[model samples]
Target chain A: MEISELKITIVGLGLIGGSFSMALRELKPKKLWAVDINQDVLKMAETQGIIDRGFLKPNIPLKNSDVVIISLYPEQTVNFIKNNLNNFKRGAVITDTTGIKDKILTEINNFIRDDLEFIGGHPMAGKEAMGFEFASAEIFKGANYILTPTDKNKEENIKLIEKIVMGIGCKNLIKISPKKHDEIIAYTSQMPHILALALVNSNHIDGLGLFVGDSFRAITRVANINARLWAELLIKNKDNILGQIKSFEDSLINIKKSVMEMDSDGLRRIFEKGSDMRDILWRL
Target chain B: MEISELKITIVGLGLIGGSFSMALRELKPKKLWAVDINQDVLKMAETQGIIDRGFLKPNIPLKNSDVVIISLYPEQTVNFIKNNLNNFKRGAVITDTTGIKDKILTEINNFIRDDLEFIGGHPMAGKEAMGFEFASAEIFKGANYILTPTDKNKEENIKLIEKIVMGIGCKNLIKISPKKHDEIIAYTSQMPHILALALVNSNHIDGLGLFVGDSFRAITRVANINARLWAELLIKNKDNILGQIKSFEDSLINIKKSVMEMDSDGLRRIFEKGSDMRDILWRL
Candidate 1:
């Protein structure tokens, strides 16, 4: 289907929503309706033309939009979907940018109206900086956009969503199961953030600011984390996240063992592994 | 006190040493001497014409040089001083480019000839790369240049070395005790590498390649650590590094606690602080 035929409504016009709207507009969506609880943010977004038609709040029923994308927190996403299910078009494809999948999948499966199809998507790109001020239409360019669907998801809806994501400049879209998606993210995204956050929190950065090298700051830079949202997401996917955290802890222990024994070789192997792994990952 | 009057000898022709030579040449130093174990690397340096004279493993005594800068690993630094301390001209200011200093300060303090002043320098910059292939003359521009001197250091020599460091592109020179420097670096450089190594090692990217985002890889890019050198450095500064590791653990625990409690507010505070810290630090 063409963009002009798709009436896209994006809830939560924050960083991701605003950027998505800007990027998707390249396809020339006829009406890019945005629903944000904050009228001020949405008004500024309107001024910037991030969205053509916008709603200040969820007070009014959503129009029969072709697609409804929730860019809210994982838990908040479910509640929004529940409240809006009745108002959306009968065959509209629903999707969200929430980081986790298990809780969202279960919630959507439980409360989603039979008439609507929800195919979960995750665009794998972001910056150290957030918000629309730094948001760009190019963030998703050449990045992986995962299309997660279960047996309940219709193939037509999945393929349509995939095509729409591609319109935003994401070059790769891979199909995956929701459970595996959560687990993989637990290892890659969640665990790394946990380690970065822990490293920053534990280090004496506040008092000994001047001594920090660019490398140290660069490495632990992610430590100043978004705690509230992260906490909810981490516990929400506790099994996967906790498992990944344990793997990280185990890795640290191995390093500690080598250090304790004065085993420079062991330590070198670990560093070599990390270096090699990083190189290989980048090879793709 | 112009560069034209100064005679300098750099023992390593890698990134740091090469940058030093290039910077000093701009000063038109009277004589610029270099020694590298790799003669091919020496030939590469000669092409740059920064050196007035070059040696592959200089048999000529480094003692005759007015300023001797040792750019090597922490352990090899002591070895370099050991093999050549007797050959040094009286009152020569000996410096090095080792990241950790506590061990270096203690290891060589008693044995150094009273005539030679060990004024250590640590420039906080490097790529994920190594050696002369990726070396740039301008890497130290606008970067932190640290001067670590003990009380035993002569006042005049300190000024002389400071003048030389500034003569290079390193404008932000900070003076601190070697112990304090090491302790701070424990949190900053040493610990970050260890965390990176652990993260890279744990993820086993070789086996599980496709699930990575640029953010995950970006944060752990440092994990492609120089293991041999890093292991030695970590053990050499074990006491301080271990302390840093502990602090990092403590920080992670707080985040873990926050996550366990599903505390989004706490998570955002960390992100806010991280974001604020990065903004301010990057400007510096």
Candidate 2:
């Protein structure tokens, strides 16, 4: 299916949804629809010419949409998919932009319409800002887009999704199992947030300005996080996130032991290993 | 007391020394001297007009230098001062640029140079790249320069050091006790390095390229660190760094328990505290 010929409906107007809308706008889809519970956001997006149509509530036109992309908090995304499963087109594709995938995917796949295809996706790009006002299409350029598709998913539907991802300027499309995606992202994404929050909580945070440097700023940049959204993410992916936090704490303990014992060899080994990992990332 | 009239000698032409030289060059000192064991570096700096004179060894002219800045590694800086205490001119303002200060200051202050004054400084700025080639004066522009001065130091000498700091483009000159400096820096600087290293060491790091995101990159950016330099720093500040690492691990454990027990309220509290800290920092 050609990207330009498809009818697309975005079911949120937050940062991810709004940015995705702007990125997809360049393709000039057959009919681009923007849906949000807030009438002001719908009107703003329409005034900005970000979409060809705006809907305050899911209605008949959405049922005939070729693709429906739900961009909401993890739990809200699952609820939206569950509540609107019957309204989706018979052969249309439905996808999501949620960070935690395992629980959301399992719940949505359990009772989703057999006539419709539901694929899980995560555009691994974001800024510290939120809302449609801060959205930019440039965030997706050359960013990694992880797709979690079960074996039951049709190859044509996966290919169509990949085509759309490429059209939106995401050059890296990685296909992995839902469980594998959750496990790796637990380490790469959620562990860093946990560490940042912990570091922030460790200090008298108010007086940190006088003593901080670039290293401190870089490590804690994500500390100014969306608390409600992250709380939902933590609860949904509790098992995997808990495992990562455990491993990370163990690593921190080992480093602390080395420092306390003045074990230069142990400390050096940890640094070398860490540097090796960072070197690989730097090369990439 | 004037910066332009001071005859300055800079030892160890590494990144810190080279950048200090570049920043001081704009002041057009009376006679700028560069000292390094690597004659090639000395020659390069001389050819580039970064220094008026270059020396392969710390000779009598260094002893006569009115102001001598030692930009060597922490251990090397202490050793050099200990070995050449008698050779320094009486009342010469001697200083060092080392990250970990308590041990360095103690050893230097224990020496027999009654007339010479030794002050410890840490310029809170650096780049991953090293050597004189990558040096830039802009690294010190508006950078925080922490000075650790004991009670024995004269007020006039402290003012002189501040003048040099200003001459080098460092607008932030913070006067702090050595112990207080170490305690705060252990949290602000060393803790971040420990966290980044531990995060990098948590996974099969070599295979992390495909699954990583911006948060991972930002958190582990310092993971591409100088192993030997950091090993020395961690060991020297072990007691303080160990305390910080313990507190950080405890914070991580708390967040982990919240996630494992599905305590959303507890998790939200942690996030709110962290965001509060980040907000304070952001305001700075």
TM-scores of the candidates in the order shown: 0.91, 0.95
Query: Would you list the clashing residue pairs of candidate 2?
Result: none
C-alpha RMSD of each candidate structure in angstroms: 2.8, 2.0
Best by TM-score: 2
Model 1 lDDT tens row, A1-284 = 77788888888876788788889877888778889878787788788877886797553425658888888888888888887666777788889987888778988899888878888888887765556676778888888888789999887888788888888999888787788888888877887777766665464544465666666656656655555567677878877766666777788889888887889888888887788877876676
Candidate 1: misplaced stretches above 4 Å? A41-52, A56-63, A127-136, A205-207, B43-48, B56-59, B204-210, B261-284
Model 1's alpha-carbon lDDT is 0.77
Give the least accurate 10-residue stretch of model 1 chain A, judged by summed lDDT: A200-209
Worst 10 residues of 2 chain A by lDDT: A203-212
Q: Candidate 1: which docking quality band?
A: medium
Candidate 2 Cα errors over 4 Å, as ranges: A205-207, B205-207
Encode model 1's per-residue lDDT on B165-198: one tens digit a residue: 7777776889988888878777777777787777
